[model samples]
Target: MKSLETKAKEELRKAKSDIFSLEYQNKKVWVKKARGTFSSALHKFYYKVFPFEVLIPVETKTGKETIAFETAKLDLFREKGILSPKVLFKNDEFFILEDCGKNVNSYIRKRDITQEKMYYYLNLLIVQLALIHNNGLFHGGAQARNFTYKEGVIYAIDLEDSFTNIPLEVLQFRDVLLFLLSLTKTRASFDLDYNYIIEKYIELTNKKELKQSLKKLANKISFLIYLSQIKLINSFLGRDVKGFFKLFIILKKL
Candidate 1:
């Protein structure tokens, strides 16, 4: 019997293929069979982000096995009180997690993102992030598509690159930027001064008095906004497709 960790490592092969291959028609989905090289961490990401069809169970000639939902990692996340897609199935070396119901990105792309409703949801998103980080984990890849909303509440997903010792400053900068970036895509890019939208949320959410959070949010993006054209590039969809690789290459030497 293969341990769940072993099966998860095996599934990580070709993470990008699975992410792009997930097909959703109405509420049903068909996921591609894993057949390429993707890091185990990223495979964990795909499983958390999307629901998939039941495929043949994977068993090695040596008698190792893979199963869904019952994996140790899933249990760990659930036990921590973190919000993610609910697990649906598990059989040797495979698992299916729930879908977002509706994407958070779609809501951000709307015309009137500065509406009070938008601010309310965004602040709620921020509080959820604060709570998750307090539990000793930070979602390294904080982006709009990672958050989801259904009914009147917000849910977070994906936990592959989290850090247990995340600095409060870093977490504040990261979470604030993600929320701001969503607004930028919808409004700020048009020269609308949307800082008030953020300020209002901060005012309403009676937490640990987020003054430092507010300050860092500005400082982090000061350079990006000055060179907004450059910082504005989509992390996933770059002009060169692999343009981020070149940017990272430049960054590594500096």
Candidate 2:
């Protein structure tokens, strides 16, 4: 019988997608490959033009460097007591992670899940995000899609974003905004009380600068908020703009 490492290597050679799942040791694991050079470059460029002080983009890497960076981030998150996927196997070309479970987005869209249960899961996510920020760390992509839920615990995944050369408070503030924005994309957003969610986060987080950052961001985007209310602009931009307007209105009150 071939070792799991050997099987993984063989699978990698035949793999077409950058990320996929494989069975190993009678359990499912996920394999991730580095982005191509062009894709990595474009990622860097997108961040370069991002119009916020909170998102200070770093140089993006590809191939072996990308794999190494992500692996290091996973290890760091574990060290900080944040729940993340355990790296079962890794190398320059690719790495494999123990299966966590379905993302919160899927749960939000499930028709059978009660509103109370959905709120419970959302609270878990918010608490976990608070814990991560309180630990002097920030999730670069703190979206619902990047989080997994299993056995009543939410695990943060997609730990590829780098927080280098950025203020910790700024990065953490960005994480909060990204998380709230992601919730707007879900069907449950309509039923959610934006004020309650924001207040809960404020109550849990010890970051004194967070409210200040929120105030600053709200002022900076006041024009965008006004435009988002316009029927013409809202139609073109969709629910995202409306969601932002709603969330920022609550933030502005803080």
Candidate 3:
């Protein structure tokens, strides 16, 4: 039997997908390939169109740079006491991460999951986000699907973004917005109290700048909420808009 590291190297040589899972040493790990040129370009294009200061996007890296960037991020988060997958192996074209567990989105979507259980995980996610912010770091992608639950711990993943010369508060503010936006994608969105989530986050961190950033963004985008009332707007986007508005309202109050 080959060692897991050797197996990973062999698998990376033939892997086609951008990401996949492998089993070795009785443990599962994820292998990720660097983003291709076209995909990297497309990602950068989207950010160019949106150019919000609080939402400033990091330049998309490709090839070996992508592997290096994410590996550094995972290490940074771990150093800051935030939970993230341990990087098992890395090279120019590919990297491997220990399987954290079921994605938080999938866990919440489980048919047997109760509302109470859902809130429990959601709260944990928020707490983790707060801790990240408090440490002066931010998750460039804070979506529910980018988080995983394992053994009573929630781990952050998909950290492919990096920033330079940006205020820490701005990055942290974007994290809060991304997290709020993600909640709208789930069935639990309708049942959740957006104000409570905002309040909980605020309670966990002393970052006054983050609260002010949310307030400023909410005021600027308040007009878009009216569009959600339009009949033609699809249910999914409408929920997201409404959820964003609710979070904004809570921020304004704070």
Candidate 4:
């Protein structure tokens, strides 16, 4: 096989192609250009060491545009003992992460897919989330897509809006909201069999606690908190922004 450097260079070139390519995971990823300054020499240097990159994520892990941010989430994943792609490179402008393949969203949406397999993947995700929360780190983005499954393993991805800073609530909301978006963005309108999702989510979590948490979350916010909360709930239910905004506007009209 080619030397590791040669392999990475080959990978980097692939990363730079098109808006981006999804060769890292199954349809997982590495990363491409920084949004604004990538064309600049200094920004490239700066992003080289950044921890995560803002992205235009698509059917693959990355998207047409991306921005890099510096953080220790890579190490956090390693330290917390979560399954993830390794971060092989970093700079002010970009950081290279291991490729996790097509996410659980696709798998879950595949219809009539086995519950045993889905639960197996979800169990991994829940365990990882529990561990991260215990350590004061938040996934910031948790959803089916952020995880990749191959053979029988799961890998977590995306962390541009992430933080280890927390009362745990911050992390919780971020992960919950983003995951909902992953479903919203990736699946079709009719693709979501929401009750099925709730069944799965409930399987991995304590339904009583989740219900109580939702009540608490809404109570602490404005009277319209239910609407905002629905943003996440609908997303998990596979309802997209198009549908969500329409519903939000209707509720506001009410």
Best by lDDT: 2
Predicted candidate 3 versus true structure: per-residue lDDT over 1-254, tens digit per residue: 89766887788778777888999888999998876332346556766775665356576466788788889999999988899999988878778899999899897755566778988998999999998888878888898899999999999999887776877777777788888778766755335677678778888996546666767766666666556546676365655455565566665665
Per-residue lDDT of 139 in model 2: 82
Clashes (candidate 3): 0
Q: What is the C-alpha lDDT of each candidate?
A: 0.47, 0.79, 0.78, 0.50
Q: Encode model 1's per-residue lDDT on 1-52: one tens digit a residue.
A: 6544344445547565433223233344222232222235555565355421
Rank the models by lDDT, top first.
2, 3, 4, 1
Candidate 1 vs candidate 3, TM-score winner: 3
Give per-model CA RMSD. 11.9, 2.8, 3.2, 9.9
lDDT of model 1 at position 41? 57
Number of the top-ranking candidate, with TM-score as the measure:
2
Task: Please provide, for model 4 over 78-188, each residue's C-alpha lDDT reduced to its tens digit, 9 standing for 90 to 100.
Answer: 767876767665554455665666677787655555656555665665665555555666665676766777667777666544232245654564465455445444333
Clashing pairs in 2: none
Q: Candidate 2 has what TM-score?
A: 0.86
Error of 1 at 45 (Å): 24
At residue 95, candidate 2 shows an lDDT of: 88
